[model samples]
Target: MPLDLSRRSLFTGAAGLTVSGLAGAGLAGCSQTAPSGTTDAAFPPGAIDPHLLGPAEGVALLSRNENPYGPSQSALDMIEYAASKGAYYANQEAAVSLMSMIAEKNGVDPEQVVLTTGSGEVLSAIAVLYGPRGPIVAPRLFWDTTALYAANLGMAEIQRVPLTDEMEIDLAAIEAAVTPDTGLVQLCNPNNPTGLVSDPATFQAAVRRMAATTTVLVDEAYIELSDDPEANSCVPLISEGHDVIVTRTFSKIYGMAGIRLGYAIASAETAAAIRPVVMSWSPCTSYAAGIGCYNDDAFIDFSKSKVTEARDMVFATLDTLGLDYLPSQTNFVYFKSGLEANAVQAAMAERLISVRGQYMDYNEWTRVSMGKVEDVERFCRALPELIEA
Candidate 1:
């Protein structure tokens, strides 16, 4: 199917789900404690290379793991409308509405959901709220946010586990690494830079084991983009009364990273503990846009389908090149280039294309986000010359 690039008008009266049934379901169980840190004091300016993407007219922008089709027409219109209200600040009403919607959809209580600007805020919060308590354990090639923030807070204990031969986390090895001082264990499902997913049952079992030792944070930023996303999420662990936090985002599948709307799920008490540490707001427009994005199921299905198609084509290309790659369950592929990462990145840059230089313990790897069909075609064409020369 050809992409629907045109804007779709949103129903003015129904920008989001009706507020009729949502009145008494307010999710204010989170403590109103003022977040402990300020931006200047909490986030050190030069913490880590933020790895910001450089998008241009002709650039493929395969570097950052972001959705290419972007939010649906309905979401865009909703954002604009919400912003035009000229509300000077982020709206808690929108957050309340979002929590209600999420709770109802997932069969969880509204108070258990913590809305943040994006999962990144919750990640940083975990560092402050939990990281200072003990050492952090994580996969070396996974999302680097927690490690970076933990360092920014001047806390030095972090253990990076090496991925297996197949680029998957060995749950047993991770369990073995947890010591008495282990404060938190972080996992990014359908992990970035590799895009491999863990079995939910195995993940829950690992959390059950780890919960006895320390808190667990499951960063599901890409879960909705995974195969059988419902089973890939760890939110259910919260219901089982585990000290597990599942952070999610509308950024990947919903194509709304710019909107800055995401959430974290934990026991209501745990959520209250993490909530006070967050400093950013999930803006009024973001909240409104999130609602619109959530309602636009058509766009979500379409984007997922397109991503699968593009991902398969890239895998086929890598096979033709006889290159080995981590079999992906998400929108990207991590492949062996048989060349130095920096050189390949520089070459791709010259072609007005951007990809990542993901260095793993065993090999030099490159990961490319599945982009639009045309962008992927440009990437496939340019990949050979860059890898060879």
Candidate 2:
């Protein structure tokens, strides 16, 4: 079936743009760099298809932020061992133990963390809990999933906040965008695509000024790769009794994406509020696998080291190309070509390599994920031709 990237949806954009108005326009005309007062939808419905690009046929450097090096051997061994228990439900004691491990690492109580299918699932849970018919504020240039998740909850009043020159969150603008109707505020720290991180002081100020009624969610999906995880997280906000949720993913630094484990750290009260909405049964076997994988401190440190190496390598390549990119603190880099990004992505695809497309700012920018060293070389080798052409 052909998917419709059209505006024929149950919910339309509020304010200046509608699903119908932005359907034919690129992301530039929408959130990323859309003119102020314009609320062009960032992603038209059904724009992405994982099936459209398969890993077996070619290297999908496009969504390459996925940890190319997956789980540690011990983690994989545990997964295989768990597979043998397929006939039975996993032990609840083991699952709780895994949750406790994550809580311990983050300095939170086990009861204050709720395990989910993945960090992505946690975002969905948030949308359902706070969205559906309210104004919400989020960074405009970001991973599209957050906005899509919000829209899925029937949110029509999605306000776009632009990134500052340094690619950090525009805290002043975010504070200004908040309205009484704003139900939630989302911050993707060490943000996806761009890999830019916000300083802690700015976050504190944002939380301080945010309407007391709005819940702030810090999606720390890539905090492990960041230079200062402690100073850049909102966990303190949750402890201070602010309405905050800090979501961490095992998929990235832990190399557990396939294992499908992520957890949200919050006040016990916030966790309790989200508990009823989480999927009651999250494939028990996966829980067992993640427990053993995340338990090893040595494995965690080693994985972080590797990601840091890849991040620095990619940044060097971007510099060599003279490509303008955000100073990445994550495993990926977002670059702007000052032209249509899809053209460059198509050019890379022609070489059997893929890069993500960005539709922001009426300019074409693309985001490339750092993979293994060899994959990075192939992408870099193919770049001059595309950029010069």
**Clash counts for all predictions:** 0, 6
Model 2 CA lDDT for position 313:
74
Question: Which regions of candidate 2 fall more than 4 Å away from where they truly are?
Answer: 1-54, 57-62, 153-156, 360-362
Error of 2 at 198 (Å): 0.7
TM-score of candidate 1 to 2 decimals: 0.84
Question: In model 1, where do residues sit more than 4 Å from their true spots?
Answer: 1-54, 360-363
Candidate 2: tens digits of C-alpha lDDT, residues 1-389: 22112221101213333454234222211233433442336336756444332264556454547676767776788787888887875565665677678778778777777777677666666665677546668888665564565574355356778888776778889888887778788778877767888777877778756837578888898887788888888887776777788898877877766567778888777776666555334566578768767767687787677767766776776788787888888877778776578778777888878777755662566787777667777877787777777
**Among all candidates shown, the one with the greatest TM-score:** 1
State the lDDT of candidate 1 residue by residue for 1-389, as single tens digits.
Answer: 22111212100111222333123212111222444543555556757223322255677888767788987888899888988975576555667778878887777877777777777766766766777788788887788755565555565367888888777987888999997789899888878778889878887899888988888888888887888988888887778888888888888888877777788888877866766666555678888888887867799889989898889888888888888898888878888888877777788889888887746553468888887878888889888776666
**Candidate 1, clashing residue pairs?**
none
> What TM-score would you give candidate 2 relative to the actual structure?
0.81
TM-scores of the candidates are: 0.84, 0.81
Give lDDT per model, in order. 0.75, 0.69
Q: How much is the lDDT of residue 10 in candidate 2?
A: 8
